[model samples]
Target: MLPARHAAPLQKGLLLALLLSLAACGGGGGGDSSSPADPGTTVPTPTPPSGLTPPSEADAQRFLSQATFGPTQANIDSLRTVGFKPWLASQFQAKGNLYSTGYSDAIHKAGLKDFCKQFSGFPNDYARNNCWREYYSAEPLSREFYRNALYGPDQLRQRAALALSQLFVVSNAEVEGTYGLREYQQMLADKAFGNFRDLLKSVTLSPVMGTYLNLVNNSKADPNENFARELLQLFSIGPCQLNADGTLPGGQCVATYDNNGVRDVAFALTGWTYPAGGVSPWGSSGWKNPTYLRGQMLAVAAEHDQTERKLPGGGTLAASRTPEQALDAVIDALYQHPNLPPFIGKQLIQHLVTSNPSPAYVARVSQAFVSGKAYDFGSGVRGDMQALFAAILLDPEARGDNKNSDPNYGRLREPAQYIAGMLRALNASSDGANFYWWWGNELGQIVFNANSVFNFYPPDYPLPGTDVVGPAFAIENANSTLARLNLATAMLYWGGLQAEDDRPGATGTQINGSNWLALADNPTLLVDSLDKVLVTGGLPANIKTGIVDAVGVWNEKNHGATWREERARSAVYLVLASPEYQVQR
Candidate 1:
């Protein structure tokens, strides 16, 4: 970008400097001077000026591990040297979308050209509609999703989109082949840090959501209450009437909206359908012979209901309202509802930080959502996702390592997250095709393949033997728990490739323990490194002893060629299976 004249001089200066350096080195000037290195690395474990100490590399790793898919050495080093806020700023600056910014190469590499082949041969509507699921949504796109989660720069956006996906609740299980689902998830990532109002509007119009919620092709005369009920009960506001701190009065939960409200809301949301032919601006001819989904659902004016629509605070929408105007009015009402800020804030906090945030924690995040640092919506808008998420992550309660007094502090590492964290931490090799999708199927929770609109689990799902909110516990039954343990064992020990029956010759994805093998001579250092990577220094003393003992036994048994591999593999498998790694505190 330099001007021609300036570029010529700069190039000359660079060449002159390079020649001088070469001559000086050859002349043996013996200059032992290395200019002071820039921080965030030079000082391997510097204390922060902010006075809140991360203290150790493991501590630093723990923070980033919680915030991201997994912590890399570089991330841990940076956080250890610079502390939390500066590292956060750098991460925020490196944001890019998973589905939008770069994915063509990944898709092409999967050998799925023309994934949407315009199939109309299947007898049933479900099969015919979902034939594309294998390539577009299931395999190829799943590869891209893996690529982004493992190596993408937009970690915060990916995490936020993940949280939003659970709330919005569109799944591949229902839609089959998932072209629209991909677009819908991308939209969530794109809008992850924008205004919540805009995010809700985009979700409302997404064809994937419309199809899943039965809102697309909806008419005023025969309205489907699915999307509308969820929009209030699940997506925006909670099921019950809530106070500012997201608490019910007198231990009693009251419904926020009755069936009548759902009916009215469905009436307002009607007459929107997918744009045909992978076209934008909606309602194009391509909708007849869909190539792939592109833009959101567009409204059909003739099918829209213009009857008096109910708004929050007993306000009624204009009787002659257009579809867009009516939808906008409803979104406005949802945004302004007193319950929305706290309701959404509580869930987001649960999603990102703690499963059981104190009312004070909810209140702080709620205030940020209600009165954001700035008004993001065009005019008179109140919610800002950027401010709200930052509040959730950086809140004092979220940041502190409080496990002694607060036993119900952290969330269980959900199946998808548990796999992702381990996969990323170890820098494992994956073709990004079969392993992730297979894992999703093996575990009950797939990334976008949650079976229904209620999501993989509810927020208030209770822990066994207690009334404590244990959301991930809902998925943890006897069989599923065994699956989690066995799957972790398979991935670390054998890389999820079944030896005899499941693809005997094909090794899907393998975890390389050559690096871990190098450190296996010393059990303390080996356990420490693995512990830091997997549990962030919180590996239980008993688990450590057991793994160390197991590795020692493996060394004794496999005194031959596989001892090194056995040592490393045993350590990873045992650590991952430990209760310490299962529930991330």
Candidate 2:
């Protein structure tokens, strides 16, 4: 029999029900868009493109699992029939989804007007109201994200938005109570499939980015270097020159900029501030209303630094004398840097497909980021977003591994990915809003709520078993592993997560196990089907045998009211808890 979820203290930073608001996520934001078609309520098989050879059913399931949130049977069938290219094209055509409700709903929930104003003269009204907007924007946005990833058809855009979120990081932890944090996330989503250069500028101007990085009200009198440093180091061109394959040239990396260069970039970034009065829909919350975050900060010409400056990689900003011009020059220079291509290319591949992508794989993606120009969504004439992403997914290295297994090819799925994949695979239903799961307590990652600019972990985190870098492993420890086990066990048998808060509540999410129980009698068949959704067919044969043997012990006579269901739950719980399903290949 399978052991039950431990009766131990629950993890911290957890809430009973998921806090969902109308907001944005990395893959959900307004940055990039795929198709014009909406993700209709029901998911149906797409019309397979003619004259294209589809991948095998197993291969299709494997690819879809990695590419989307998790593979749906309908989507899996569609991918196999349409082939990779057409399937991708169809995904590109899917439209983005946003909150169905308004920001006012959040304020209404706080009920400040009825209770506080009626009872007492509230001095902390500013702080009070700000909390409402931020609270609603934060978790509710994640619910929307999960809904889309699990059921929405815009899988590619969602994946791209997630990848962009990691790169251009802005956490709800940092920018709460400001202009709907959703806009910042939407900015990244809107640009995920757009030009990288455009994404950088948009992020630089975003209110959420400004708050997170302290760049919104940046001034030349005493410049803030935080955003500038991260912009060059993390977002645009990295500090070191990565070779085409993403390794140091001859194992001796070269620096692109020095201290003076960083300062110059900082000085160049000055002259922007939150909207005037700060209380308007899109500016910094002001002295009048200090708590509310406003819209994207606007550039102030008077505050601009009009001095000579040195550009990164040996250039002068002589031509860029104004704030906007200077900022544009800086962005263009950073985008064109040779390092930007491979630096971002490798990380993008790591994020979407595998952790330790081969140098050849890195090079292939790098080329796409640089030279691929087959398709364009009309954002700009330069660097087609569609082309860049298509290269990463359709490349021989990324897809070829699906045909031939590479022992060292997969990534350990991050906590959020693990939780999300489970929900998506099981086809869990939710209200789309107020859907909540305390992933941070168990997995150390909440939707858009990273603690720092570094994101959940450093991209170059080295795996414990090997010296190879694996970003997702940074959160992988005994405690978290145990937490994952607890979560898997609870999800399988307990219906879903419990509200860690004082009040009793639903997981804001639950899956119908009827389909699961149908195949409970044959452990092999049951396990194989789940493997496609959970592990993408990476479960080793020996591990499969172990799981089959372990789950077979639960039978009708020994199990509960829904004996077949209990057996199925036991099988899924074991597989989900196993080390085999934790990593993604």
Candidate 3:
């Protein structure tokens, strides 16, 4: 029931060609040095800054802020030699074998090919292959912990908690055969460096994303607004007028909306569809198997709705338009909007680097976006990844060091971040049945199974009377809150420890055998590890003290060896679950 804006056929062809050219040319490469280096070889370390033997706390924090999930000891060591800026530049241009080889191979083996094969054909005989469906189809080990909370043995709880946490952040490589998978992996492997615009286009046409956002079946006649709405509201320019500092004018609270603007933009996004010659259904007569054609989400003229549409505020476009005109208009408007740079740049900083970047910091990042000095992947000037990392680490506001009672500028780690961090930390593989088991439950972020398209939780859930943008204030009702608390407790006791090692004939033998406190006995090590992996270098002393005290209780009671491990594990779960972890600056 939304208004529609169909582009002229001529315009569609022109835009499609332009996009193809840009994609082929790698867009405008941003201004970073284009000298290629061997991705397979490690760069030699630089001398420490003026007699420094190891990285300082500041150095560690900077490293953690930009890397996906958390840093490994190896990763930290590498950063020490390259220094932050150059290391960041290298990440932007990184190539093959960058991820752990074992992990990468296992991901490849996880029926990803089958999934890709199934998704290649759409809107015809092609079977639907929902990633979420695949994930939940298997009964992950974390579920047992949930069951234990309700009826099973209390002793089995901590194992489940760790499994859940692991599941929360791990990225699945199930897109192997799908056309979009390669592109997405390229973006990720590019060290989280790429053009935001290119990333947006890639996500728009990706089968996983198309399925996630319900854009697959969108047609001219019955134009689905789901993708269009989110593209503007969550993924791009965002929903309001804003100052350059990322703060809204008039000091308005979070969750404000430009309802009319959303509607107008959605109208312009009409008429997008897959290529002509509809895909063949499996076993159907005259049906042909569909192959993935790169850049093939074409606008079918016959399928397009050419009705003249009224804009939300009051304007009209001519009827029977082409796809190019419609899409270009929307993208251009969004790109030029004043709100875009600050709004999106801040979110990227929040997701990739820090929680609470200062207004000035946001301004600097946004300026890069606007001026085309940063995030311009076409020129290869350090793609979105390099610009974003620079903004997060180098910006003065981001490095503000007032620790005593400073307002926390971090975001609550989404389930994905938490899970991925754990898997990376454990060097776990997704091919095993234990995939996503340890972290998913602990953090409550199950991949491919967000509760709604609004996502696991609203990005701007408001707090009581504050209208402040923080953690899950919007969705944390009584049931959810209780669930969260119970989830936290369960994670500590059951999710942290792994189940009896699954070696054949292992006979229920406990691994790390009931000594939950073992990791916690050395509070310094535990804290340091958590700081290294979870908080980067930015954990508050008070928070560290709380974890230490909790560890003490576990140690004193001679808690089961398993319980001891759970307590130590709980320290991390607790930190990740805290309010401070959820709100990115």
**For candidate 3, lDDT tens digit of each residue in 1-585?**
001112112212423432332122211101212132221222221222323344454454444534434455556667567555555455455343321211121222332334435434333332144333222222222232222222222111122122222212113322222223323333333323455555555556554455445555455545567776777677666666676667666667444246555555555665454333323342112212132323435554555556665433234655757756666555555556566667767665555444445555566667666544532222434224345445545554443333213343344444444444443443332322232343453445544234555555554554444324543333334444334434434333343333434322222201121222345667666766666554544556776786667655655457554444545665655554444333222
User: Which is the leading candidate under lDDT?
Assistant: 1
User: In candidate 3, what residue range of length 10 has the lowest lDDT sum?
Assistant: 1-10
lDDT of the candidates, in the order given: 0.65, 0.64, 0.43
lDDT of 1 at 8: 9
Give the lDDT of residue 294 in candidate 3. Answer: 30
Error of 3 at 522 (Å): 6.5
Error of 1 at 247 (Å): 1.2
For candidate 2, write residues 386-464 as lDDT tens digits: 7667766765555542432545566667776787777766667654333333555567777777778888888887665
Error in Å for residue 377 of model 3: 9.9
Instruction: Please list the residue runs of candidate 3 whose C-alpha ends up more than 4 Å from where it truly belongs after superposition.
Output: 1-55, 96-192, 206-222, 252-268, 275-295, 305-321, 354-356, 374-385, 400-405, 422-442, 464-467, 472-585
Candidate 1 lDDT over 1-585, as tens digits, reads: 000111101112423433332222111101112232211111121222234565366556656656787776667777778877656656655666476422222222233344345433444655445445433464445656766778788777787788889998987777643445567778888888779999999988887777778888788788888999999888888778776666675559887778888888989887786654442222334222232345777778878898897875367888897889989989989998878988898888777666777765666667677667421212223688776776666665655443423445567777777777877867765545454456676666768778788888898886655546767767765556566666656665444544322222333555556667788777778878888777767765865886788777756555776666667766776677665666665
Better candidate by lDDT, 1 or 3: 1
**CA lDDT, candidate 2, residue 160:** 82
